[model samples]
Target: MYKIAPRISQLTVRQVEQFRSASAWVNPSRSRTESGPEASIDAEKLFINPEVQQLLVELTGMDLEGKVFRARRTTMQQRSHFALMTDERLSETMDKMRREAQRFLSFIPLKEPRSEEVTILSKDDDIKAFDNSKFVFTDITFDATDQDRTVVVREVDGTLRTATPEEHDRMNRVYYEKPNRPVFPPPVFKDPYLQDALARKEHEFVLDWACWFYEPDDPAYVNLVQCVCDRTVDNNDFEVLHSTRHFATLVFYLALNGNIPPLLNYFGGQGRIRDCANLVRLQKRLLPNWRFAISTSDTDLKIVTDFVKQNSRFHEALKDLIAFLKDGVILSRASPKVGSSFSAKAVPKVHISSLLISAFYS
Candidate 1:
């Protein structure tokens, strides 16, 4: 009873190229300063991002915004314990701290399924003869399933550990051949080949291959999807991710990392007001303090309007969303049905947000 995991690429509907770059894209404000390569990498001002501020403001409430001053009665108390920092310097320091915190949060990993146990085969004294190439061994017993098979690797430095999920997949492919699954990962997963594939708008293809070839938690797979998903978001290639599963993956990654506002804007620009509403709802559910159980009877418009009423900062970053809703109301003289065809049910109800929050500590 062998079953193959469906390729995300083959399952996806290739999007028709639309001239979306010409459209004014309303996105979270980012400050960019001319410096060097590092500056470009750190250009995103996460502290100023409305979504980040929204979550922080909710969680901290008045503490984040309130300032406390101590009244000094004694002369000793009145004497400053330390030199006072100027407002400009204090602001810069706060921004630096926030950036560091944001960077740390983004790198945090989510919960992954259990990995195979590793068995050590070599010892310190016996490993000196080996070269740099690590040897990976796989158990191919008739009773062993590809997933449950034992795969171990002996490092060149004499450390023996379980094969990484990527290595295990490669070993499995080597022992039990599967069409399109290569023993060695395709060069397309790397450098110029990846760039070329992205340029040709083969994002789905790349994503499918990456998922098929590597475990979902594999670093390479994660990096590849981030690149592909970011490009798809930037280019407004929404049609390229037609599969509900693939779309859910995109949403999970973006919402997990707090980088989903731009995707909402894309939906708004495409006149997908329903989508914008659902996305906002999804974002709210991902926040620790905001995960109140949503009523199944709540309409999309109600969900969005409730959020808009409470969140003043979204007026700017979600300008497209606001305008889209307004236009639909005026034109249709009815509740907008845009993007309703793609139901929120497309997203899995597996407590993905909970997993993300737990992963922050793990």
Candidate 2:
């Protein structure tokens, strides 16, 4: 007869309790039902089974005694083996599924997201050809917080992740860097004297050049001239005599030709004639030919008046000049002797008006 050690029995009891706890078997009803002779027989079989005894000792450091529990021993081994096999099979299945998924992905043609479609619509379509063969893989990581959230795309490296903003910025910088290509240079003034004269507010020189360069048909030249005119106006000291003279000459020629496009285009709009009427007075002294032609006759006066009305602010000056001519005051001041050369004859200051009339007729 074998003597059952009390310590070994107590260890077995602890092992049973531990297994019950791990399996969550706290049913009071089951415990009550199993307290009978049937339960005692089941307990005796579990202690006597060699496999159950080995498993108990290995798993829980407990030894079985007395009779073998064959039914309980078989049940426990089946439960543990089923759990282990199920986990192993699941892991293998997942790995095989992942490989198959990758193979299928390789066969199917992949495309960039449609949001990239507009990149091809640009003028240079040849630079935007799509090639699916060099497709690279990427992953996104998301971080969560109540106040702020961020998502980043990164290339996969085993299990570690890194941001791609620096790479993106570098690519963009390279793509947009200035291209090394030739472009046409702006037109430059060829005349050294004229260029040097225009370097200051040489209004007379500019006026003369404008008169020579005024081509209504060539838009490019006109635009270039206008740019120079604007630059002269901006850089020249307006109060200086040369600056004022240049402005005066510009107005005089603009009025004489009745071609106001350059003035209108340069100044951005039609301006009051009176604003430059003082220029007319100055032109009378400096460009007598211009004044002689403009103030010569009623027709010439009409031309001047029309230009003044269209583009001048000096309405009072125009009215006064028209009134003076009409009243014969200007004619009396310019009384000329017949058959006299304009320069050699002793012509009265009063004859200046007659000279003006003759110049208009000529």
Best by lDDT, which number? 1
Question: lDDT values of the candidates?
Answer: 0.50, 0.30
Give all TM-scores, in the order shown: 0.52, 0.19
Error of 1 at 58 (Å): 28
Tens digit per residue, CA lDDT, model 1, 1-362:
01212221121112111211211111123211111012111112333355644443332212112211223234465554555799999899778755554442232222232333334443464765578797766678898777566666777787765666667777888888877787888999887998777666566568767767776545466556666767776665655453212455566446544455666655655555466566665554543344334577877656655555454555576655555554431112111123323321121222223433232223
| Stretches > 4 Å off in candidate 1 | 1-127, 130-133, 156-158, 291-299, 309-312, 328-362
lDDT of 1 at 105: 28
The per-residue C-alpha lDDT of model 1 at residue 16 equals: 10
lDDT of 2 by residue, 1-362 (tens): 02322322233223323322111111122221112112112222333345433322221211111111112323346533334458889888767755553332221111111110111101223423333232222212244221111112222222212112233222333333433211221123435654655565353335434333322212233333444544544442222212122333223223323333333222211122232333333323322343233453434334443444443443342443433333322211111122222211221222225544333223
